[model samples]
Target: MPKYPAREPLVLLPCRLPASLVARFAERAREQGVTLSDVLRAHLTVDEAKPLGKAVPRKRAGLAKVSGADPKLLRQLVGMGNNLNQIAKLANIASKTAQPMAMVELLITLKGIEKSLEKLSES
Candidate 1:
């Protein structure tokens, strides 16, 4: 077998997910020719926030309605794409400290923050 970079140890988490969802993920993993662990690892390795899509011009009235959200917050959210990259790098480091669980929590918290920002932008 060809050698590859040594992967850091992972702690198998017992997630209380719906059986159907679990089975779906398992099937997807199989279709991708990877183990479930590989699928999760790929997810965990994402280091950047991706754009929702191409920005579309809004009507003046619609823009006014969305402007109710704080301008600074909107700017931060618009610019937060790079921030997620940094967070992922930190998560990679945190993986080595025997506190990957904490790192995962941090990643989830950041995702929630990003989602909330998107909600505001969509309004």
Candidate 2:
């Protein structure tokens, strides 16, 4: 992957969206409970990825809505990420002080994290 030399410049755009679109946009923006700019960036980024001639269909054609966001599962994912880091430390010790079987448990933990990530992506 090519690395960017600098952060992308931000420009404030003032524009209007359709009524139905505004509703969908508002719903997605609310899900993050963050700044409106963040949600707009996410949606518009998809547009940036597409070919210029192939615009997203109007009235739910190109619009993407957020769904199936499990807060509890999100928390679990965060905790699991932290747990994996801690396990790395233990695995370091285990490699010297304990048997190779100890690393198997770490691999299982990693697999579980991967599965959780996949589930989140699917949602």
TM agreement with the true structure for every prediction = 0.31, 0.37
Clashing pairs in model 1, backbone N/Cα/C closer than 3 A: none
Candidate 2 TM-score to native: 0.37
In candidate 2, the residue pairs with backbone N, CA or C atoms under 3 Å apart (3 or more residues apart, or in different chains) clash, namely none
| Most accurate candidate by TM-score | 2
CA shift at 34, candidate 2, in angstroms? 57
Q: Model 2, 10-48: lDDT tens per residue?
A: 667899878898788788778878656666666665556
Model 2, runs deviating above 4 Å: 1-74
Model 1 root-mean-square deviation: 16.2
